[model samples]
Each structure stands twice: as C-alpha cells, then as structure tokens.
Target chain A: MIRAALTLFLALATVSPLWSQSDLKKLSDSEITAFDSKLKSRSQATETLIADFRQEKSMEMLKNKMVSKGVFKYKREDKIAFLYSQPMVYHMIINGQKLRILSNGKNQIIDLKNNPVMREVRTLIAASFLGNLSQVGTTYKISYFDNKGGVVVVVVPQSRQLSSVITRITIYFKGSNAEIERLKIEEGSGSVTEYIFTNQRINTDLTDEDFRIN
Target chain B: MRISGLISSILLVVSLAGCSPLLKEGIWLQNTPFAAGNVPYVYDTIPSTQIFDFTLVFKKSEVTGIVIIKTAGAGERRIVMTSVFGMTFLDFELKGENIKINYCIEQLNREKVILLLKKDFEILFKPDHSKITKYLYSSPDRLDALEQGNGITKTLMKFTNYNNKWPETIQIEHPYLRLSLLLKKTEYDPESI
Candidate 1:
C-alpha cells in the first residue's frame, strides 16, 4: 500500500506542473481579449466627440531665446486656423481642401495635396478631436493613467521622422468627457510646444463664413 | 602757317592764364575737402533692454552689414522691429544679457534667420579684432583721418566722401531677393531713457 501511494504522489506532482502552465496560458489569452475589448470600447466612446476647441500654444526656440504665443482653432475634421498675435501678425486657415496663409497682409493660397506634413498634422489633430483613439495608437504608443483632475494620456511616436522632432506628447483629458485640457509636445532639440485649451463647446453651430480664408 | 601758329600760341597763353589761380592756391580747384574732425564723440553704456527696433543690412557682394538699433524706454525696454518694410519681424525683451526674441512669422528657413541675427548682434556689440581689421582695410584713409570725437558716423562719412563708397549703405544679395538699405538716422540718449 505504501509503495502504491508513493507512485501516485510522484505522478500527481509531475502532472500538477503541466496543469499550472496551461492554466497560466489560458489566463493570458483571456486577459488579452479583455484588453482588446476595453480598447474597442474606449475607441467607441470617443467617436461621439465633435466640438470646437481653442488652443493657446507656447513655442520656445533655444537660439532665439523667445517664448512665442499663438492661438489655434479646430472644428471637427475639416477646418483649422492658427493665429500669431505678437511680434508679427500671421494667420493660416485650412478649410477642407483650401489653405490660406496671410503674412504681413499678404495672402498666399497653397494646395493641400503637395503639403503632406501639414495635412498629416491636421489629420492628427482632427483624429484626436474626434476621439479616433485607435488611429492615434497606429501613429503612437499610448499609455493612460488617472491624474488629480482627469485622465492623462502620454503618446510616444512610432515613426522615425516624428520621433526625431517630437520626443513625447502629453494630453490631459478634462473630467470624464475626454475633452483635451492641455497638450504638450516636447522635441528632441529641446524645443517645447505647450497648448492649453479653454472654453470648448461641442456640436455648436459654426458657420462656413467663420472659416473664410480672408 | 605762321598765322595758325600765332593763333595756337594765343590759345595756350589764355589756358595758362586760367590755370594760374589753381597753381597759386596749390589746392584742388573744386572745393576745400570737408574735414570730419568737428563731429563730437558720444558714448553711452546703455542697458541691453533699451534697444527697441534693430535692423541689419548687408552689402550686396560682401558678407558685412551695418546694424541700426533704435530703442524706447518707459521704465523698461520694449523693442519693436521690422525688416525693410514696416512688417513687424521680431519682438523681444532684454534684461541684462538675457535677450528674448519672438518671431512673428514661421518660415522654412528659420535657422538662417537666427544665424544672421546672431552674427549681426555679435558684430554690433562684440569687440572683434578681425572685424576692426576688415573695416579698416575697407577704408584705410578714413581710419587714418579719424579724429577724436568724430565717432563712427564721421569716420563713415569721410570714408564715403573720399572713396565714394558708403560702407554704412548695406546691400544684401541672395538668390531670391536683393536688399539695399541706407541708415537714415540714429539717436541714442541714456539719460532720456
């Protein structure tokens, strides 16, 4: 009886190791599925965000030793405008396919097809504003955590060119609504651009006249 | 033949008579050369913050340029500047050595602008021996004739007068644009600020 008991005990111990390994594998697979589901849910949640955002940008250049301030406006996926009020007067407006840049009271209209970088930047901003969080993941490795006021999303670029210019981008989401409170872009060359958003309104009526290039 | 020879002789005598006054005076017949010695030298140890509007114009063929600086002080320096046009270019505040320049427009060649501005400032304030040599060699007689209290303007004016080359008139020749500038006026007063 003692010999039989010893053989059974040894067999059980060997089988137990295999059982635990398979159990861990199953747990990992389920965890991955849950994570994917969570990502999909978050992406879906962001799809309903359509609004006008006001951004105040601060630009710093090391050689120039100046801190520049500018205002940025974005409406949905189509229109955007950047205005610099100090040192010089400069304005750029992009409404759909048409882009107009006014410098020193002279206006220049540039085709959007040839300017891929501007298009990409505009798309990135649009995507973020529309809550296409998954698209951001395609361009950036994103990590999120809760902060004192809201959620903080940190994005690190996946592309070499983007990574070269921008080291990291931090987005602060206000409240539970995921409205961007602030966006900070830090460059590899020690230049930084900080944008603070205020007085954001979603689905408000913005006319086509408001986006006129002039 | 004798009559023609007599006519020629009379003409030569008339010409010699006209030239006699210049020979007696032993000076150029046009005018006495204006001396630059009468101008007064004015120096001010201005706070870097006092400079408001700054412009730099380079020679067309050469890399050298003259920098024009203007300032407004209402307790502190608030500088406003533009390029050739009244197009506002850079705005900055200076506290001691710390200078802040904010660009009004973003250009593709921003690095070039920054570099040119840096070089301009260095030429303006820094005591560079090589620059002094270059300035002197460009107008050797001007420096030689530079009298005390004449300052840079008198030296420049004399150089322009003698060489017919205005070193202060800067020209910038580039592939895209050619720029020429003449320094119209300059005013500096530390006590007023």
Candidate 2:
C-alpha cells in the first residue's frame, strides 16, 4: 500500500511559479511552434543545470500554504536529482529507468519499466527541465500564452485517466533564458503545488556519481 | 452433518472469543470518566486543524510525508497525506462511522488496507469508549490502555498527556495486522498560512 501511494504521488510531481493571469493572451499555432523550437534548442545546448528551489503548495480548503525548500540537479540526457534540505532531508534521483529515493536515512530503488504512471512522470519531469516539449504532444495538448514576464506553457493531459487526477500543468519561463523559472500543477481537487527556481547555473560540470544509487 | 459441524465450530469460537484480551495481566479500571480532552484531535476545543511530519515504515520500505488532519466538527474529520514532493497520497473524510474516500492512490485501493486505515484513524479520533470492554492500567508505563475488541479482532490505543489536558503523543497497535501508528503533535507556524 505504501509503495502504491508513493509511486502515484511521484507520478503527479512538479510545481508552480507565480505570475499574473490577467494580461495573458493565447498564442497562434505559428507562435506555439516557434516557442517550442526555441525551448528545444535551448535544452539541447544545456549540458547540466543546478538550482535552488522553493516549493509552495496551496489548497483552497487548507488553512496554510505548505512551504519546502530544496536543491535540484539535472545532467545531460536523463539524470535528475532533487535533494530537500528544509522541513526534512529527502533525496530523489532519477537516472534513466531507475528511481532511487532516500528518506529518513533509508533508501529504496524502484524500476519504472513496469509502471506506466512512473514512466509518464519521468517524461513530464524531463520535458519540464530538459525541454523536448513537442515530443509529448500525443499525451498532452500543448498551448502557448504570452505575458509581460515571458511565456506560459499550458500543458493539459489528453488522456481521461491522467486528466481525472491532474487538471493542468503550467510551466513559466522568464525573459529570454527559456529555462523553467516556475511550474504549477493543478489537481482536480482544487490543490495547487508551485515551484520557484532560483540561482540556476546552466552547463556546469556535473559528474555521473552525482546521480548514482547503491 | 456438515451444517451441525459448522454451527458447533461457530459456537465454540464465539464462546471463547473474549476469554483473552490482547493486553494481558493488568488492572482493569472502572468508572474512569472519559472526557473530550482525554483523546487527541477529537474536538475543536483547541485548533481543529493540525499538520504533522509523518513517516510510515512497512516491511523493507519506508515512506515519509506531511499529514494534515482537520476536524470539521464533532464526528467529521478530513485527513490528507501528501508526499514531500507536494503530491497527495490519500484524501479521506470521516463522518461518524461512515468513511468517504475522496481520493486514494490506485496502489492502496485494497479493501483490507482501506478498512485498516479507516479503523486506525477512527480509533485515533473518536475512540469509542463504550465499545472498549476493558481498560488496562500498567504501572510501568504510567498510562491507561484502552482495549476495544469484538469476536474477530482487537485493538489497543494509548495516549500520553504532554499538557495538562491534551495528549501530545498517541500510539495505536493492531496485533493481528502487525500495524502500529505513532502520531505526534507538531509545532504550528502561523506565518506559513
């Protein structure tokens, strides 16, 4: 039961960036493709990325917003790790199909080959950071919106299965960096989890041992 | 002949069901007044909503997350457990004896697991003292144990009072399922709201 719940939560992973919703307009098809290409090229150029992240989770029913801080690391191809410092010490590393989670000084590694939900989560996390936005077009209906800050990429799940749990995922990029400055995931139950990234160092030297799991 | 055998077995089991309790060799207390302040998070006398850093260890796997428990009213409570990554694992609503599963992950959708969790939380919040057939007082622990049982299963719940009225820690143990839950009250931050 614990394993099931853990995997399901991991599948709905990632969070928000704060931006105004008032001064936004939907982009045309041509604009969407151009932005997608720009993001794709930017990701291809990035070899490694390291950032400090602050996650804020808000629910309409909850009295307080849940705040947590962590460090995020992503290497070329498909190596990603999130090490949380505040609240508690938790480390999660996703290297290819293997996912290693360390919580409370205990470690457990899970293979994502058998679980379709986890596979989709891997894809979503990768696309959110490393780009390849158009590759997941079949699973998510991509829409582009222009705002004063930069661009907001609205991704809605096409499948009824995923849509039932997660309503939408909005990725925010500021200025011309094309990096994900913020991400917000809206649940069907009126819960929103947002992540804000800062102090990003792109194309830095990150070794394979950084994402290793024993 | 088969029907007679089944009836005999049932009668024997029923007769010997309450003969032994899970908690053994302790003084049974009588006329111990049960108050609202005795149990943790039962009523809204002090702050209805509570957030805790929860950790569950089962077999070889261990999962840690944040659990937010809110008391809507007397018998109505909402429990939501979210991962450290901000994804929700379980969302449950309890109204009296009936429990509504607002949302549960597919992995934990088993009837046995769900029933166990429902019973666990119910025992934590409401704690039907009327159903408790015996109250065991252990001199070593300096705590009174509430033993509630029926023909099939038995459960024991113990509360440790940190303050003058309310308990700061609650421990629930189910011998049959080998399940134990430890709930501790965490410091509330007003600024986080």
The numbered model that scores best in lDDT is 2
Which one wins on DockQ? 2
Q: B11 in model 2: Cα distance from truth in Å?
A: 18
DockQ of each: 0.03, 0.28
Best by TM-score: 2
Query: Candidate 2's residue-wise lDDT over B1-193, tens digit each?
Result: 9999999999988877746666674333344333323432332334367776666655445566777888777778888887777777788898888899888766667888788778878766655434454555433323455667654456677767545545666667665556666565555453466
Model 2 lDDT per residue over A1-214, tens place: 9999988776645221223364478888897777777788888888899999998999765767878789999997888888988776889888999988887677888787754555666688788666777678688988778867488988898887677667788889874868888988887656889989999998888999999977
What C-alpha root-mean-square deviation, in Å, does candidate 1 show against the real structure? 18.9
lDDT of 1 at A103: 56
Cα lDDT, model 2, residue B132: 52
What are the per-residue Cα lDDT tens digits for candidate 1 across A1-214?
9999999999999899767534422214454344434444444444222232333222231122232235556665578776655444556678777777665455667677765445655665665666665455587776655565465666787877556555677777664555677777665434455566665554445566656865
lDDT of 1 at A201: 51
